[model samples]
Target: MGSSVAGLIGWRRATRICKTFLFSLILTTASGAVAQADCRADQVELRWPGGQARFSVELADDEAERARGLMHRETMPRSAGMLFAYETPRRAQFWMKNTLIPLDMIFADQQGVVTRVHSNAIPQDTTVIDGGDGVQFVLEINGGLAKRLGITAGAELRHPKIASSLWACDVE
Candidate 1:
């Protein structure tokens, strides 16, 4: 009787361990899938007078994400950028505090038209770079790319956020 009872306890213990392991595996797999989907690259296009440039940008639409924008990163690909979207049009300001790499900040309106461009912002500088009133979106790219590509104030930005408005996406 004693042996039978001990065997039963061991079996239950083993079952519980197996269950915990399986649960952990499932949770890890699900979290990986979610991260992969969220990190998928989105594209934005900038159209100027005689040239156009396309970039793969990560969206920073939420407060927490925007607050942590590109800080402490040692390097960023020239073709990649971060797009900050706002709920409404208002003046915007950006600083390079804690940012390890220099960047060019492009300020755009609600319609995705470029309103201002702050080029070669010094890294870790706290000075505010202001986007004039009615600015709704801000795109940050590697420093000097704006000048190299000839992106100016008149350039128009096209992304999903502005596609529903005046700058509609070419495709459905």
Candidate 2:
């Protein structure tokens, strides 16, 4: 009777260990999936020439997002624009290689005024579209809309995060 009782206790201990191990594995996997889902920005509202236009923008602040800029997407919403925030204002250039949809690149200064506009960027083209000197931010929108709306150099942008980050309000 004593030996049988010991065996039963050992079996129960093993079962408890197995259950704990499986629960840990499930919890780890769930947390990882949640982290991946939260990595991309869902929507962003930006100020444009027309007014405050809300966009489902993908923020390209790092090398990963920069490399994946608008590629493979079948369509982009009209009110949406990708906002690429850089460390400093410089001459930025972009090309439409592997990009599925046409886009209008609106380049702006640190203060958000449009400094240059590259409209109708041809997909699969390696030709460099220059966003001339002192360009801090680049907003990608639908093709030809920049020209139609007169969203050229000197167009101001108004994103709360962008404006606050790059403006005097952020100064120490």
Best by TM-score: 1
| RMSD to the hidden true structure, all candidates | 16.4, 17.8
Give the RMSD in angstroms, all C-alphas superposed, for model 1.
16.4
Q: Which has the greatest lDDT?
A: 1
**Candidate 1 ranges with C-alpha deviation above 4 Å:** 1-41, 163-165
Worst 10 residues of 2 by lDDT: 30-39
Model 2: per-residue lDDT, tens digit, 27-132? Answer: 2332334222322344433344343333457788887897788888888866677888887888898999888889999888888777778889997788999988
lDDT score at residue 20, model 1, on the 0-100 scale: 57
**Each model's backbone clash number:** 0, 0
CA lDDT for candidate 1 = 0.79
Write one digit per residue (lDDT tens) for candidate 1, span 43-134: 67666665666678889988998999999999997678999999889989899999999999999998889989999999999999998899
TM-score of 2: 0.64
List lDDT for all candidates, in order: 0.79, 0.68
